[model samples]
Target: MMQFHDAAKTNRSSGKVARPRLLAAATWAGTVLVLSACGGGGGGDAAPAASAQVPVTLGTAGPGDAQNHLPLAVGHSWQFEGTITEGANSSPTSTTVTIPSTRDVGGATALVLRESVVAGGQTTVIEEALVKDANGVAVLAAADDVLSKALVPYWELRFPLTAGAPFVQLDKTGLDFGEDLDGDGRNELVSLYSSVQVVGVESVTVPFGTFPTAVHVRRVLELTVRRSSDGLAFDATETGDAWFAPSVGWVQRKSELVGMGEKLSSLERLTAYTPGSLGSAGASQGATSTTGSTLATEPAWRRVLRASASAR
Candidate 1:
């Protein structure tokens, strides 16, 4: 189970709230949001040994190519079951991700993905607009149940996954914290930066099944919180690993967050998946359709942090 720390007692200087509430909330939100999209096992679980490796062939055809490891199509959904642990207490969790429709974002067609996560008896829903191209999959925008505004887009995955090569996923500053912590009547500023690298290929087993050609990707996120009132700042970091199977999306994921004298760890595995159909005609039609507003112009990380705060 994820734990929320008491903001009042976290960092107090002269009886003033040095570290705002959003500091912990943003850290937790970033950790969960970053780790929730992909797949992998628990941090303590290891992949199969070399002797268990299996030979398999993957498709390389267009957007739905198995090599991309993410097949985006409307109506596709994935269900995951897992456990969240903080110290000695643990709680069961479940997540459901679905692609319900398509929209036009940044002159490209993007699929709308809705993810519902139930943890600690609370449900949080996240909606992301994603685009899959030859370059890989990227998020065009994001929104959650708590925030009325949508977040700006960022790269979720890059093409040509290779080990030892790390790419910057997001590096932006002056992001909104979406709350007026410290009773300052003004929202704080936040800086979010992250990088991702493909570790290697491994065979992973979960409730769904055993996948021999799962691509393992590791991501490291660093968040810096700065108070708009007086320039007070603090730092937090989260490390996560995700496994993607050929033609199937994410199979498992593990994440750990540490900061502000708090640590949280979680592991999730694919339990069931239903693939959607996006025939050649449908794909072409999606490209020509211009339905929704471009999502890149909105505030990006602010909504994510706010959503997590509400979850607690």
Candidate 2:
């Protein structure tokens, strides 16, 4: 099993908070808001190659940290095709999605565009959430303590199962990470945040070869804390796995939430990265000053349309 650190006691140069008191009240939380629509790609229609690279590494370090970093440029766009399973009781839902360039949104670390089944045909939408940081930038920062505090008993179990594996930043709230599967000395920690914690390390066997595993610890903070044995509390934890790339962070990831007498999972396969046109079009702006007010009220489907166009 993975060893979890005291989330409330870890380092905090990055504004890490005590385990959120009510994160468990939320079924899902993480990431940013607002992103221009993209167009093109997949098959012969793949969008033109982006001018720069998109950062896709994983870990709890700063951008400069070689372990977890991203090459994703400001105006880059990419496609994501996967399945969304609401729960074991529900049928698996397949989705073909994309994330718009990060160059035009506010407080956005990442944008997700998803299209899935609706009443009749399909629905496309964008999840424009916000990534809160001390500096207020949409950028990702690591806060091990905050995350550990949130994920409890369940995390203790899950963390041990899939240590050192890549997992998605369920929410654009900030941060992502990918492990360096290969031992070539390249840092592949993709993204990270204050709510998620990486505790211990493990080695597991896979189809590729032996890999160093990363124990991902996560839990939902209950609105009200129930006292457990001693002084500990009873909280829910969700665990998952991720595989590191050679030089890149995580080339693929699969995550799940198993707690509160239930389990949920999401799998993502990331291939390439590209810098979008906005980065080239507006060279003066930084990620923090983008115009993302549209995210506050816009529906997700509209964002999907925008991302589809941007890809083109």
Q: Which prediction has the highest TM-score against the true structure?
A: 1
lDDT measured at residue 159 in model 2 versus the true structure, 0 to 100: 19
Model 2 TM: 0.36
Per-model TM against the reference: 0.70, 0.36
Could you tell me how far off, in angstroms, the CA of residue 246 lies in candidate 1 after the best superposition? 0.3
lDDT of each: 0.55, 0.28
Candidate 1 residue 179 C-alpha distance from true site, Å: 2.4
How does model 1 score by TM-score? 0.70
* lDDT tens readout by residue for model 2, 189-304: 11112233343444534333444643234432211121111112212233344444322223344544333344445655443434444432312224443333322222221122
List residue ranges in candidate 1 displaced over 4 A.
1-66, 144-151, 279-312
Per residue, candidate 1 scores C-alpha lDDT tens digits across 1-312 of 102223343221112232333322221112211211011111112221121111111223434333647767886788999987776789999988777777776565678776777889987666667766656666665553222232245557667766777766655444455565445566655544566778999999999999999988887665545544455555455677888887787889877655545556788899998877662211223433336442221222343333333312
Question: lDDT score of model 1?
Answer: 0.55
How many residue pairs collide in each prediction?
A: 7, 70
